[model samples]
Target: MPDGNGTFVKDFFIVGFPGLHSTYYFLVSAVLCLVYIFILIANGMFLFMFATNKCLHKPMYFIYINLVLSDVLFSTSTLPKIIARYLFQDGTISFSACFFQMYLVHYFGAVSSYTLAIMAIDRYIAVCYPFGYHAIMSNRNTLILSIVIWVFSHPISIMMVVRAFPLPYCGTNTIIHCYCDHVSITRLACTDRAPYSFPAFVFAMVILLGSLAIIVFSYSFIIFAVLQISSTHGRLKTFSTCSSQLIIIALFFLPRCFNYLAANVGITFNANLQIVIILLYSLLPPMINPLLYSLKTEEVKKILISKLKKHQVHLTVLS
Candidate 1:
């Protein structure tokens, strides 16, 4: 293990976005910034609708609101920092700031994973034991679950943060990605230790793989239940509601799990693959969530369209 606690690694290098001419990179950045703006707006709307709408005050929507909140936080912690570094060309952060960024990134990432686990449990109760769904997944229980996620994530994230600070880094401090991720910094550590790497892998397993296993197990039962529905219409109706969530979860989980698992095993990850993986993880999940709800959900789509038309009407009236 490398050890450079007191001024061993002074500076780091960040190799911004891969394979774009300066002009092309600028154009891409403009588009990405616009996309991020929409992510904020759309996720905000989900949170607001869940809060304000009486009809949406249910366990399912409650978890959805948490999911949106987690997604927003995850993006907020990571993307803006990346954009500032790569797109804006201001790629410098102090040691403390870097650690803070890493901590928050892991914090929110853990939150999102735990939130997904709660959603999986919610789905299990709703689909598998429909009669007890209300009593089992009550608002109180959901709140408790959310609280547990935050509490559990904090200590685990803090462990990673604690281990990272002791490394004596006097060499390059440039991070290859936009954010101060653990992997990039770990590789740059002057004094590496099994503790840092192992804890990170442990957290990833607990949060990422643990949640994924729950999802798979719950959905397996769900699929069985769906198949048992006597009516084809009933089957389709049940499947339709869950399909979007399944897609969203898979998109969110697969690449992230792959990236981390590969990295943990000491694989030399391809930078180009990293960009694609990170982009999909960061952008696609948020981009698709609103689309899934608005497109596949009849009620949500109707409401969204109505809202759009109402805005148009207001403009027309003013004009």
Candidate 2:
């Protein structure tokens, strides 16, 4: 359906996995629904703790709140439609709606990347410059940095959408991925997408590599500082503190770097395999972040344990 401007304004169908059979739609939807529920519950609990517990209001946790919000919002933007796509066999998304999702998907991704970088910086300061960490990563300064991250991520994502949205989409309206993104949607454009895609590819690489470089730089110093510890126990303890973050960094960045590079460098993957890779990198971090990053911390654990004991006491009285 073309509006008065003669541009085609039509809904696009999201083909989740080209190789997935309709018979397994219900099963897949159920599994995704469970994952979505878990993400909400886990992240939601951490958010609640952050809100109520003043002890968790350090610069590090302040930065983590952004990651939590980004994760939940990203999952919200993507999961429902795909869940419906599988559960009800309805994958149609209006043109405007699809582009909106594309913006959010990319925006949140960039936010998470930068947030991780910022977290690495926080750890670097804590480990390498413990005396000055408080002054440098103050509550106000951390808040400002988080604000910068949220605001700074917008332009490239908005430009990606702005550039790709106006292109003529005709004939084939099926998107071969779980969600609407610059690459998946722009590939549907009726004109030459090379010019548009090249810039987007560049932007994606810049975001990924730029943040990765920061993490690596920060951690290199952190590793050096940790190794300088006089005692083996001190070194082990310091390394333990950073191990969770290292795991998350690996999960979030490594796979995505591979996917992007693979797509551009003529490395081919089966459609289902590619989609699986995307979902793993995009979805897994948000789901596991609370457990690996926040809950594992001693402060958070002590808080959770004290609260649980209080709850148990209340239950006993009620009984």
Put down candidate 2 lDDT per residue, 1-319, tens digits, no spaces. 2233345648888999996888999999999999999999999999999999999989989998999999999999999999999999999999999999999999999999999999999999999999999999999999999999999999989999999998998757889999999988988888899899888889999999999999999999999999899999999999888898998899999998998888777798898989998999989999999997556698899988999999999999999
Candidate with the greatest TM-score versus the true structure: 2
Question: Candidate 1's residue-wise lDDT over 96-215, tens digit each?
Answer: 877888898888888877777777778777878989989999988888887888888888778888888778676556666767777777867766556678778887777888888988
TM-score for each predicted model, relative to the true structure:
0.89, 0.95
Off by over 4 Å in 1: 1-7, 10-13, 18-21, 193-195, 312-319
All-Cα superposition RMSD per candidate: 3.1, 2.4
lDDT of each: 0.76, 0.92
Error of 2 at 176 (Å): 0.9
How high a TM-score does candidate 2 get? 0.95
